[model samples]
Target: MRLASTIRGVTYSFRSIKEVLAKANSHKSGDVLAGVAARDAVERVAARAVLADVTLEELRNNPVLPYETDEITRLVEDDLHEPSYAAIKHLTVGQFREWLLETSTTGELMRSISRGLTPEMAAATCKLMSNMDLMTVGAKAQVVVRANNTLGLPGRMSSRIQPNHPTDDVQGILISAREGLSYGCGDAVIGVNPATDTAESTRDILMALDEVTRKNRIPTQNCVLSHVTVQMAALDLGAPMGLMFQSLSGTQTGNEAFGISVSLMDEAWAKMKEMTPTKGPNVMYFETGQGSELSSDAHHGADQVTLEARCYGFARRYDPFLVNTVVGFIGPEYLEDGAQITRAALEDHFMGKLLGIPMGCDACFTYHARMGQDELECLKVLLGSAGVAFLMSLPVGDDIMLNYQSTSFHDIPSVRGLLGKRPTPEFDAWLSEMGIWDGGKPGPRFGDQTVIR
Candidate 1:
């Protein structure tokens, strides 16, 4: 479809070219036609560039860029926030999940995100962070590929591909390549999730990323390195829970995961101490997800009025790489019809901000096979700004494409500009200073872990 659109554009450009040439025979008409031709020619080139997969930065940064931002700027407006738009467009699942977690404590976040209501529209222009975060690599990947592609790259894979096979490494390789590409593209601060169970695993993931850079020839500048929650569960180590700590410590994976989750988190300084070796401006992400049942119980310790302050407090103190949280509804319509009404009531009537709301792309509903037409994918995009996190969802691409898009490429962040060089040691020092290592809290630390009876 994208190709078809480009081809159609090229055909139109040619038609304009002919008209311009014919008009060139006359002096006055020729000048206007010539200008039109010049514009058309540039548009033709840009259309082709899109076919080749251009980045937002490329399109925006080009001095001679043909298409003006205004051409598509209309798509950037509030109507894009409409539920109808999101129901039919691209939806970013993971980023949406992240946003919910980030804003869970910010009472300012929106709620009743089911459908018919656009989170972005509900918020004002002061709410720019949502779009900013959406511009990140993760968000771009989601919007560009949709949910269909397996590898998170341009093309799709066959069912015959095996996991251990080279074909199966698509997601990891794409992640590594995108990280390197992002660095080359001026994204210096990289967010990484190392789901390693051991020291060797962490080393392996990092080594793999380094290999991607080396192989792809990406320049290495000082960048921040933040460690996500290490694999700390009994399942992670193939051990049972409540076992003596020493009994499981002998295993490499067991020790590494344990170290990060328990000791590193227990002591902010110790956490920072271990991160020092990475030479980074490090941030730790402690993510937690309560099952559908226990999730309701989350945030009980914090009052509605203090949610924002508390969440921000944790974010400021820990300065995490990213916070991963989750909020799921009983049905997809939870966001659209009635949900929107409830949200309006909370905001308009109560003047309340519901944290951990989902931002959704319009297409999420139709593409999600699990739900019928009445339900839309209840996803939200959250941005960290104004000392309060904002949750907003806009319709971009569709469900058929969500998976595919996610695996196809890195999502672009909302912030535009080249990545600034930050010493990795800085990140490390920050983590250490936060007492994330020795005194860091361990998991099941993040999200709601309590199971329902």
Candidate 2:
């Protein structure tokens, strides 16, 4: 479903996962509203109180913790207050569309979308179905969704070093929407697709992010730009198109091209780490599976998938908190069965695997078109049902869109209403058994205060 359309329909229940879990565990209403209110106070006011003590460096150092509701609340409050935190407040579909109309560029288009209640407006409403809770439940939701194997990966682009056009821009936009709008507006990594793949191009973007962050005071030392898909070192987009995955009739150079692609990826990683060091709890966004030369012939092997996994595993190993998943698969390619591989793998292999860390996805944008509105509705259910982060891609004329998801974890006290009373006794029992019940008096330091040293 196009998130932008659903922004107005967005309503937050002002509750906490911990409280809901408690209700599930005991089936009591005694503390439900109170638990939810405590979360709201922490999120709306307390968290923001601690902002002065924190710095980009400190926030990155600890980042947000799974149960650190206070910290996340502050981050959201800080973003809302800080005029420069464009990614947080203004980027919302409702706010963004309004801003677009105000900007010199895309203003006319914004006017068009603003005029009547069109499907675009409906889609925009979904964008509001987002939150700012990154730690606790939001993070847990990612784990649960990943475990459920529902989301899909949007394929990568052939051009390694593509610019921010409609196609490549869509990826980043999607990341933001998924994390920001759908799942407590948390953080996820995103990449740029340059028309060419070379160390220089990669370096240029890294440098650009650095400069932009510094210029805009966004602070770059804490973040890592992700490099997923077909990454290799020293290989420019030039170089004879090579073997062409689109038409691999026979062994051209005995699959040297494939090996080179892998090597290029290595180089890309090395360079990225060098350019954007993972200081503090920085992140690197990466994804895989670009049809590339294989568009015509789908002869992918387990090794390729393994390579992707290894890429993720490597990120996990290098800087435990620095790498976040943004797995992308183009077209109708879901996980092994109908699941999204990253989500499927996480659910099947990574559940309870990592205690504090969270896994994320690109979103549920590519569900089969034939599935129709069911897919869209299904996505909504997934968002509210599982807390899976979603990324929204804004339109670029008729062919391109921009990607948007959270850059940091956030909490939302608004989603409580979306979830009616617990569904079944079995589910409730599972909640109790899982020890996921929400309890623990709201921490004393409910406001946003971080140790910045």
Candidate 3:
């Protein structure tokens, strides 16, 4: 018999394994809401205390600990008042939506809310909003915040040249970097995932990348994406901390599996501060994806997207230089097709930005997921509209090591050109000097030179 069900007088069938996975993955949105409810329940009494103006000061003072109800209640009733609560006291959801839309800067809005409401409280109230209202808030937040603040990203359109090497082949890495830079990408950074995961391998790759970058006078930082411990060892071996790298997850357990801990991150940050960069801070690069919690068995029944946001919260603790959500990389088990992939990518970008994280989207998918380049392209343009900080640069839209299709080096100039954007200022100058960028338009070489010469 067919595995089928009837709903609202319509019957649906899971025709293939992919369809089954799609149906299973479609429950993630509901799971997210359920997870939120479960999490909010634990803080329900605290949330109410804040709403009742019962314990605002105590909560603010002891931000490090879990809330104690009786003490907080007594403190709240002791005549302490929060101005942020007062600001939103008489406003309805519709009114708040209008206010948020009209607000010129997120910093001001965030500051006002910080006086009283915790992010959980704000998110709880947001749950009452309709999807359209939530979408409006996300869109408005990005516009106002981006227009008014740089967040943590560089102040121009940037691209990351991800010359990921499976075998850490020096020639392959150099060729890939050369190709991406020739097409006016790599303004933000040129990073690689070494074929082997070890301190020596990572150091060797970083050294090789450094040699090529200096030899060609390319204006970009370099990274070797191995385990954090390996990279830390590389730093101990005298690799510059200009481009520290890590992949973070929402839960503590998830991080432990990757041999990452908050203390380790702190050590890396401290190490970064010890190094000097020619431009910008020695920023760290972080990659996170939805379904990671589930894949790692750390999901805790929450929506994957919600868990993904928690990952951002964790990453933000470090003030990361770059936070990229590889939106569709998890495959059909979590996000089945192009439509789900596109929606998830937008949601991640919107949520990340709303949470005040400088976000980027690796709009990519795997062949096993039954998705294609066209869908990724759609997500890329949508993210560009949302003012994503940067995107991955593969050679000709294909990553041989990762075995995935993403926006290629050529796609960068085309997307930026269409949106009236340019690479980060320093990289733009380098591109101009190299004759790949002419004024605001791309030079002829940009279109003609797809392969490394």
- Top candidate on lDDT is 3
Model 3 ranges off by over 4 Å: 1-99, 103-155, 276-279, 444-453
Query: What CA root-mean-square deviation does each model show from the true structure?
Result: 24.0, 24.3, 9.5
lDDT of 2 by residue, 1-453 (tens): 111111235422313222212122111111222232223322322222222122222222221112143322222233222322322222333343234323353313322322122111112221122222111123232221121111211211001111234433333533432222122111122234344444454444444444432342321121212223333231242211111111111112212343323334345445444533334232233333322223223222211221222223223322222222332234433222123332332331221112112333333233331223333333333444443333322221011322322112221222222443221132223223323222221222222122100
Better of 2 and 3 by lDDT: 3
The TM-scores of all predictions, comma-separated, are 0.31, 0.35, 0.74
Instruction: Give per-residue CA lDDT, model 3, range 263-354, as digits (tens).
Output: 78888777766662424443677898877867777654444654565566566555566788887777777777787777677666655655
lDDT of the candidates, in the order given: 0.24, 0.26, 0.61
lDDT of 3 at 367: 81
Output candidate 1 Cα RMSD: 24.0
Candidate 1, residues 1-453: lDDT per residue as tens digits?
122224444442222212222221111111232243224444434433322232222212221111242211121232223554444223332233344345342222233232222222212111112323323312222101110111111211111000111222435433433432321221222223223334344344444444543453332221112232322322233211110111111112222433432334435434343433233232232322111111232222211112211221222223232222211222222222333322221221111122122111111222222433232221221211111111112112111211211111111122111121121232223323323212222113111211100
Cα distance off (Å), candidate 3, residue 19? 26
Each candidate's number of clashing pairs is 101, 91, 3
